[model samples]
Target chain A: MIELDVTKSHVLHQWKADSPLIACRFSPTGDHCVSTSQDNRLQRWNIADGQKVVLEGHESWVHALTFNKTGDQLISGGCEGRLIWWSILEAQPKAIRSVEAHAGWIRGVEISPDGGMLVSVGNDQVIRLWKTDTGEKLHEWPAHERHIYSAAFHPDGQHLLTGDLLGKICVWKLSDRTLVRTLDAATLYSPNKGQNAEFGGVRSLAISPNGNEVYAAGTHKGSNPFGAVHEPLLLRFNWADGALTKSHVCDGIPGGLLYRAAALNDATLTAVSGGSSGGILLFFNATQEKEFHRAGLPSLARDMDIHPAKGLVATAHFDQHLRISALFA
Target chain B: MSNRARYACGSMDHALSRRRFLGASGLLGASGILGGVASLPSKVAGAIPKNDYRVVVFNMHGGLSQLESWDPKPSTNTGGPFRAIATSVPGIHISELLPKTAKQMHHLCLLRGVNTAEDDHGKGAYMMLTGRRQTPAAEYPQVGSVAAKMLHDDQTGLPGHIIITPGGGGGRGNEAAYLGPKFNSIHLGGDKPPQNSNKPDAIAQEAEERRHLLRRKINEQYLSQRRSAITDAYTHSYEQALKLMERREVFDVSKEPQAAQDKYGNSELGRQCLVARRLLENGVSFVQITHSNYDTHNDNFNFHIEQVGEFDLAYATFIEDLAERGMLEKTLVVVLSEFGRTPNINLYYGRDHWSKAWSVAMAGAKIVPGAAFGQTNKEGTEVVDGQVDHGDIFHTILRGVGVDSSQSLIVDGRELPIADPAAEPIWKVLV
Candidate 1:
């Protein structure tokens, strides 16, 4: 566990590598961290000393990396359209399963809480679900017309949520592989009167752990159609009814953006969101339910993962650094 | 008299005896002179057939600079890196960049001193296209919408107004404001003709039969509802769509000789212009075609060259085609840009935005050809003489099409002048 200064946020722990790091995740026990990079390598590191247990065999950039619920298996999906499963033994990090999953780049990969299922979404606009142990094809569904950016298995393991390039968010049923709901949550009205206005697309999506709410962000700048900036839109929706609960424009956020977010904690719920401008792990506490607490970090974070057991936050940043922050009560 | 009877009589009287009644009633015509005057008020309603002519606006979105194209000043510091060539019109010169347009300059009028309020793309587009500032409460309809409202014929069977590739890089400010969606221009998003717009094989064979059936069904529906406005609008749009579908053969450019296509170039912008010509030939009162990607803050020279080359060919071909078809006298072609680029090149060898002084070219209609309307300074930084803004330019275009720019539109419970209330058209350029 690392307790760094809250003020000197610029001090980031760097992970030296030959290629650019794309994704990072922490083990359930918070003892080991896994990183996937463009160099076509997945390195498992000891969280204490940062030593690497390099896993090889992938021929392209590992676009997505995920650890199963039990922390005994690592599943990686890549741009080359292959999904590979690795058995997590210290002596032998052996590939247990590999399959040709998609026609285009696989952008998203998620493992169910029970470790029984694996779900992946790709640029080919299809979402494929698989049985994690047997590599059996569970189902495939047409999710979006364009690229599917992110996908996740709901905590209950019975539903799937996916976001697409056209700013469409869809909820799919696992049993029937049917689209249960679609939300055009990024629809924006023209601020200037008399002009018909529309937004670009959705860039990222995150769901609350309780499955009560989901948030989506839009990709575009000012109200001006000619402006070349990507602004963030936070949409909160009721998961059960598929109704929009609240839509908030996260003010004070800059125009250009690139990053993803995740919900943290279970009881007194809060979320940690960060992006390209800089890593801002904002604490949206709902217990007493005040405003958000702005927690600042050094680099621009790309993707982040939370330790399922200890709530330790591990962030992958564009600065080629992976730093773990331990939350203190 | 019953309200329905009074309305029908008033319409008939207005339609049949307009000139005789206007002559007898004098300037402020009293209501008593009109029949059923007490029961039916003399309200200005429906498409009023004025002496107004039609305007076809070609919106070149990125600022088309004056020095590099229309108002070339070869001897000045801000002049084009190339030379200025003489046009078909004596004493008028344009940049060598526009060879084709130059030859056709005898049929054109250049406004060299146009300026706008904003330099930013969105604001500039809104201001230039709408002739009004952007507001949150009320949308000022585009010029096309206004013209359509004033000139659209209910029996015309085609959309009164049309916009080709209306919105893309710079979102459209080209919508009907308070007039609502019924008057909104049918936005054809791209150059290609609308998909499935042609009449289906079955519909073509049973055209007269279907029309009779539709007329009967509509009369039956109207008998119960007394001609609801929603139903009327729907019927109007449906008939317009059907009419356009039957005329799909007009949009096929392959009918044009290969030499014509070569002259227009095979670019999308060129194709859109060709389509615009077809639309005008088929009786669309107002058509606006937007050409985008003029925001050249980087690689200015290379970008301008490619853009101007395409524009020169397309515009020249459009003018020639219209003239050849004997449609030039009736169709007014206005080439306008939002603003112009800065006089000085930035560190990136690019020019930033500027709205101080620019140029717009017009041809056909009542506009006197081969005339330069205004002038800019030596450095091309400011308007030197006869400065014009959105209001003046709009008034000029309107007047060219015979529209009285002094007219008023009702807005916010008050009367608002149609053109900029303060500016007048450059009458010297109009025949």
Candidate 2:
């Protein structure tokens, strides 16, 4: 078992992908990390050895990835809205099934905690649910007025949360596939410029362990059409109470952008994917007053993933490096 | 009255006058205002009345990504999310985002290699529009002004050059520079006709006619003493603006069946294109329609989808409309930009300005239909062959629309070629 620790921040290991690293995720064992790149390759890196394996199938940029509970099966989504299922159990990874899931770019993909179901959201403005064991599409529904960005399942696997470009958070009960609540997340989205195609929407989203809350982050404070919202934003929702408790703007940096966010113990971990500047990682407690940790990244951190057992955070950057950070005890 | 679609030409005049408050007479053009039209190649001039060729330029104010537009590098890293689709031409392919335009490829001449040496927005725009570099030496007339000076016939009862939504920050200079304000466009757009074009509901039509008659009499008295080119220019500018007011009904598209407007897609670009067709049909020699904010420094893919979605439908519909009206063979439609986006994608998912190996699309008279000319190297980083620059682009455009590029602008005794002398028209793209 990997040791768990929390203390001073430092880079643990980094593997160079040599192209814009788009999405990163930790394997079920936590000994390995998988990253998708603009080069259209999915790379598996040995966290300890720095060795790597490239699984190629995507014809264009790959933005989303999810691994099955067994860790042997992985599914990735790409700009072409393709869902390619890879069998990572073999010494050489191979694509098992590739489905033309959405009509346009696949924005995000995730699996249920039980790994029985897979969910994918795309610019086609729809969210689709699929069987993990088979490629059977279980359910599909229009999720947003505009392009949908990220989707994640609650730890209990009872609820699914999705975000979109129009600052809308849709909570759906997985059993009935009915929307439980609709939260207006306009604070995390820049109003005037959010509708423009040039600005991305609620790019990253995370749900709390108990399914009681969600933190959505993307960009805020867009002033015009030419320049995107550089200011990174975070909105914390208490769904059980039906209130947005905290709206946090990543301060100290002007025009910062938040690309991906994950629900930490009591804080929200955000990846500020600098529009044209640089990327940053920030952790804000539930109240938005205290910051647990913050670090500057080399370039835009397109997407990130948190380790299941080791408390590790892996960031995929445009600089072509997948950087890892771990908490120390 | 629906007040939405109305735009006043006076606001532009005020804005220009504000910039050139101390309006100086041309240090460029000679004291003869009519010299410009008379200087047109004589043999071509008389035939032009029978020919009646027109030009419509769609200026994408900011740079457009070649990968996402006319040139698609599908397997390249910078290709982003889009795929290329085959056009009507067997081998030519364009961005799938332009599905509508894809079908109309047979009507287009795609110039995939344009290396205009300037990169900055202002300078690049000036060079692309004028066929002249940004020089402190003198301001050159834009393509519209040149078309106006060459093709305008007063008998048409319309302004020769009309720019829809002119303030798109291409820094379209006032006074038409050496060509003078006489050839400058009459700016008009929006929900209503040019403001104050129709006398207020309170004013009787006879009263307005009386006011115009009195003004014309007063203008005659002033013109007798001030008979120089500068005086003639001011008179002509006011006269043209008045002529537009009389013909303002052309701005109202409601007269057309709703089905016609629906066909154009109802977006801003759509409305402007519909207006462009109306203007062109009514004898506007040159019409420049601008669509804004393609400066996608971030989220290039998404923006291209949105911007080009509007552009594709509107442009295709407009082209088809013109063809159905039998105007395509006599009108030149060109889509141009300051430059293309870089082949190198940035960390922002954006591409910066790239001058090398950009592309422009042209259709109508004299253009070789469905031919994709020039070639960019693999990865779309550079032009490997047929490297035509902005001057050459202007030369080809002038030729296709029947403008004589060899004509001289007799400015202050210095002769300047209509287009840059060093550049020649791409004959392969011409009929």
- Local lDDT at A139 for model 2: 95
Docking class of 1: incorrect
Q: DockQ score of candidate 2?
A: 0.40
TM-score of each: 0.49, 0.91
Worst 10 residues of 1 chain A by lDDT: A188-197
- Each candidate's DockQ: 0.01, 0.40
lDDT values of the candidates? 0.65, 0.76
Name the top TM-score candidate: 2
Model 2 docking category? acceptable
Task: Calculate each model's fnat, 2 decimals.
Answer: 0.00, 0.41
Off by over 4 Å in 2: A1-7, A191-200, A224-229, A266-277, B1-50, B166-175, B190-192, B411-414
**What is candidate 2's lDDT per residue for B189-297, written digit by digit as tens?**
4334555666578879899789879988998998888666656666665676577778887878877789999999878778888888888888888988877657776
lDDT of 2 by residue, A134-219 (tens): 98999998868888888989787788988887788888899988999888886665533222233547878887766777778877
Per-residue lDDT value at A141 in model 2 = 86
